[model samples]
Target chain A: MILSEREEEWMTAYQNGDEDALERIYTLLKQPIYSFIFRCTRDEQLSIDIVQDTFVKLQRYKHHYNPKHGKLKSYLFQTAYRLMITKLNRRKKWRSLLPFLAPLQQSEELPHSDRMTIREAVARLPDIQRAVVLLFYYHDMPQEEIAQILGIPIGTVKSRLHAAIKKLKKELEGGYNESGSL
Target chain B: MSQDPFKQDRHLRTKLDEYHVDVPDFPMKPSRWIRFINLLASPAKDPLDPLISTPSGLILLKIAPIIGTAVVTLIQILMFL
Candidate 1:
């Protein structure tokens, strides 16, 4: 994912404390970030919150963005990914401590549409694999960038994508049975 | 033998395109920003709140006398002087 020169300029300006540059960056990246999060969590509100938090984190940790390290988009995605994992872990712990208060978990019903099947299969993926798949396919990021965003080796990213796609194929083709085998 | 799943990548991409999850308009509501700022401005929780909230806090409370003895002796000597 080579960023355009204009995008890099905006990022640099934002890093230099240009609020307008920050706003532009937000406008450009918001939808894709939100969509990535929405697909992963399947929760609209939580996705929105995470998007906002990602930017706020960018603002708060402005110095952390170094072009020498990576592109701003990759940095933002990395921040959001970490935040999403933290939120999911916290939710899991809360659910375990207070089962009654946990949100109703989605049932493993056979999806009616191919799109729905894809969505369900994605939501069911282990967190790391799902992140890899979303960044790779939907975001059109190269495996190297995904590795940078995930802080994993490109080989690990490749393997995760392979495993995730394999699982999705199984789910979509086999359909759900009473036993809930994928 | 199972088919190569990568062959289905195109299909998955198409399905992903068809999947419509509405993205809300950005530069989120000002009220939300206000709330976020207020949260930032709000006083931080007491540092010892976590320690005191748990059994360790109770243990600290029990040992307060033993911990305070040195300070108490210093105060007594200062007062006598």
Candidate 2:
């Protein structure tokens, strides 16, 4: 993610205790972060909560944002990604303990027009693969930046993307032959 | 199988364009700043907490032994005088 010079300035000002700069940074980033989390989690409330948590984390760790290290956008995404994974893991553990607490039916809330085969196939992917695909395709992030955000090798990002695309194609084409490959 | 994956990527991108997820309005929460200020203002329960909490304390910790050695040498020189 190539941040504009103005965005970088805002990040610098934010670290200098400029509240307005912080707000501008928040406004600039909230939607992209919200959309990414929403697409990944499929839960509106959880997405909003995670977005709030992401900004709170940004405020707490404002000094950590340095353009020299990486883009501020990637930093924000990394924080949200870690929080989302933790939340999902906790939810999974709870679901295992209480079998009767059914998972939220997110599909039923969507309108018919939004229900595309590709979206469904993407949702069916494992968490890491889904993140790789979304960051690569939806966010227009390069493989190298994706690797930096996810803390994986560039080669692993490429393979995960290829594997995810193959899985999506197979699922969308109705030939989902499970060969025990994740 | 004949379809190129790049073509599929274009198709997926088009499909993604058609769907719009509404972003909810969230007010900026400044509670984190308040918590940080509280941490600074509050008294430290552990003796090491203050040293670890602030940058100046960390610098003092690093130079304390050198300062102690210099003071001891100065006292010895004064005793010889």
Candidate 3:
């Protein structure tokens, strides 16, 4: 299991209404959840908000987690993902109302770079593909579990991963040699 | 430089690893419910705050006049009593 035994115990205790256990679990998993949201959203304050929301969500949905089905880490990531997606969708609607603001938003979103770095390439990927790449490569999530977290089929996961990898390769080819990318 | 896609994949992983994120310190961070309540009472933090720009906010804005009238009516009733 990606989660250690002690962490799992904390999760169990937390579910049982042990408030003290929450600090331990939050200390352990906060970084992972925050980074995952940050990579996906590229928004600092929004990432922070989503991470806190994920914890609050854990308190609300504690009884809903099943150890047999998945680890607590995955559960937190799934909650964070849903929360981020919901906020992103809401932001999208607002952005749509003022289409002219897109360019201004983009300019502020990324700093000027002489070349496209791997980070920029990853950030430039479509939301769905970027998510698959981050979850698979960064988090080391298996396709099946990723499918569960993302609420997509295994086949879709595979295809999205394939597409994301291909796009990453093309974008990073300057640094990538024939042997492999570095 | 013989072709090994797995090697390329690993390289890509290595490149991806370059993007490191720094996690902010975990204090006893307050729950999001508290944040939302604060946001509603306070000025908008982010200009593009999702709460202020959503249908929920729009509904509230639409009914502000009604709420204001109801509050005034309730205050008048209390004063009369």
TM-score of chain B of each: 0.29, 0.40, 0.33
DockQ of predictions, in order shown: 0.11, 0.09, 0.14
Per-model RMSD to reference: 10.9, 18.2, 10.2
- Model 1 lDDT per residue over A1-182, tens place: 34545667898898777889988888888988998888888766667788988988888888777887777778889988888989878868966776545454343333455333666777778878988888977787878889988889988987898888777767666433322553
Better of 2 and 3 by DockQ: 3
TM-score: the better of candidates 1 and 3? 3
> Best by lDDT, which number?
3
Model 3's TM-score against the true structure: 0.71
**TM-score of the first chain of model 3:** 0.86
In model 2, what is the error at residue A37, expressed in angstroms? 0.7
Q: Candidate 1: how many backbone clashes?
A: 0
Q: What shift in Å separates residue A92 of candidate 3 from its native position after superposition?
A: 1.3
What TM-score would every model get versus the actual structure? 0.69, 0.68, 0.71
A9-106 per-residue lDDT for model 2 (tens digits): 99998888888998888888899889899889888766877888899888888897888987788889999999998987876785577533435446
Ranking by DockQ: 3, 1, 2
Chain B TM-score, structure 3:
0.33
TM-score of 2: 0.68
- Pull out the clashing pairs in model 3: none
Query: Model 1: how many Å of interface RMSD?
Result: 9.5
